[model samples]
Target: MENYSKAVNLLTDADVIIVLAGNKMAKLEGLDLLGKGQFEQDFPKFAQKYDVHSIGDAFDQQISSWSEKWLFWSQLIEQYTNHYQPSEAMMNLLKIIGKKKYFVATSIFGHFFEQAGFNENRIFSVFGDWTLMRCSSGINHGTKDDRQVVQAFLAASKKGQNLADLVPQCSVCGQPMELNLPLNDHFYPDTDANTRFRWFLTGNEEENLVFLELGVDETSPQLFEPVIRLVQQFEPWHLIAADYPQADFPLDIQSKSAGLDADTATLIEQLDKNRDF
Candidate 1:
């Protein structure tokens, strides 16, 4: 209860909120890449052929053909993202942030923040979003919306049509296109969004900002040390980590930070309940 009060107070008094989300938040939003929940049952083909039991394993495997790869990719994307609904915790998070100046830096690439109505400019998807595709030729061919291609594949699949010809190609390089994910060395991060996120950080260096760590775990090493260092540098800055314990934080920022040691949903729910807005 004391921890919840501290978290709520930090949020309420904050002039700006910076949300850092990771794999566990992805799991809450129905895209658990590491877990084996229904992976074999739903994707029996990949399961039987590659012995891949989870989305992570499936992505790590090199499918025999581009046609097979895109078909499987489309199915996974459509299954996880096509009908995505913001979970209760997401909604509660919005209420907690209620008109506050905020920016989101997330490694979850499911387009959840955009779908949940966050300003697109304020979000930096650090891992890149799967809904977009880029050239596979190891060149910076730029990204394009692949929702249409996904839909086309799904439609054709319903009619039992082959999806070989439907595989999207790069218009500039005439090479096959792959998801805008960090699947290989060719994956590119969103530079424009990255710049914006950096600008937001520099712009609010002195403000009473709250860095809300939601489900950030070891999988996203990018979000961990840098954030802690930032908090240590900025005296006015406070950290409210949902998954980390208070003892885990450095001694320097311990007075100004709260490590709730709870799941994202529980922390957000508590904040929502305790907040005045």
Candidate 2:
């Protein structure tokens, strides 16, 4: 109760909000990549062939052909991103940050925030969205939308037809296109969005900023420590995390920060009911 109230006060008082999201937020939105809940049931062949019981394992498995890889990726993307629905937490997030200056930095590649009506320009996907594709030429040619190819693959699955001919090719080098995820060292993040996120932080340095952490765990160390360092450096910046305990926060910012030690969904639900927003 104490931490929740502290979080509410921090959120209400802030003029700007910076969301640091991780895999737990993805699970809340129905994209549990590392879970075994539906992976084996949904993809039995990959499970049996490669002993891969999770989407994370499947992604790491080196499928024999590009066609098979695209097929697997398309099905996953279709089930997650194409047919995604916003969760209660996502709705309450909008209410909490309503009409306020906000930016989202997420490790989830499912495009959940953008689908939930958050401004795409203000989002930086550190891991990259799977809805797009990049050239496989081992060079940074650029990214292209894979949604159209995904639709074709889905349609082919229904008719039991081979759509290998429809595999996307790079317009620049005529090589096969791969998912834009950071599966290899050649992955290139969206520079424009990165620049926008940096600019947002620079502009809000003097504002009352709430560094909101959602579902962040050990998997995304980059989003975790740097945010805590930022809160420590800026007097007006407060930290609100759904996972950590209040005792874990630095002494200097403890009064201004709150660690609810709760999941994203539960925290957002409480915040939604307590405040009119």
Which of the numbered candidates is closest to the native, going by highest lDDT?
Answer: 1
- Cα lDDT of model 2 by residue, 1-277, tens digit: 9889878888888899999999999999998878896998888987998899999888888988887888888899999998999998998898889998999999999999999999999899999999889999989999988999998888887898886787899999999999999998879989988999999999999999998899988888898888888888988899999989998888988898899998999889878778754
Q: How accurate is candidate 2 locally (lDDT)?
A: 0.90
Error at 29, model 1, angstroms: 0.7
Clashes of each: 0, 0
TM-score of each: 0.98, 0.97
lDDT of 1 by residue, 1-277 (tens): 7888988889889999999999999999998998885898899877988999999999999899888888888998898888899999998888778888999999999999999889999999999999999999999999999999999988998999988999999999899999999999999899999999999999999899999999899999798679899999988999999999999998999888999999999999888877875
lDDT of 1: 0.91
Question: Model 2 segments beyond 4 Å from truth?
Answer: none
Total backbone clashes of candidate 2, pairs 3 or more residues apart or in separate chains: 0
The TM-score, computed over Cα atoms with residue i paired to residue i, of candidate 1 is 0.98
Candidate 2 lDDT score at position 239: 90
Can you list the residue pairs that collide in candidate 2? none
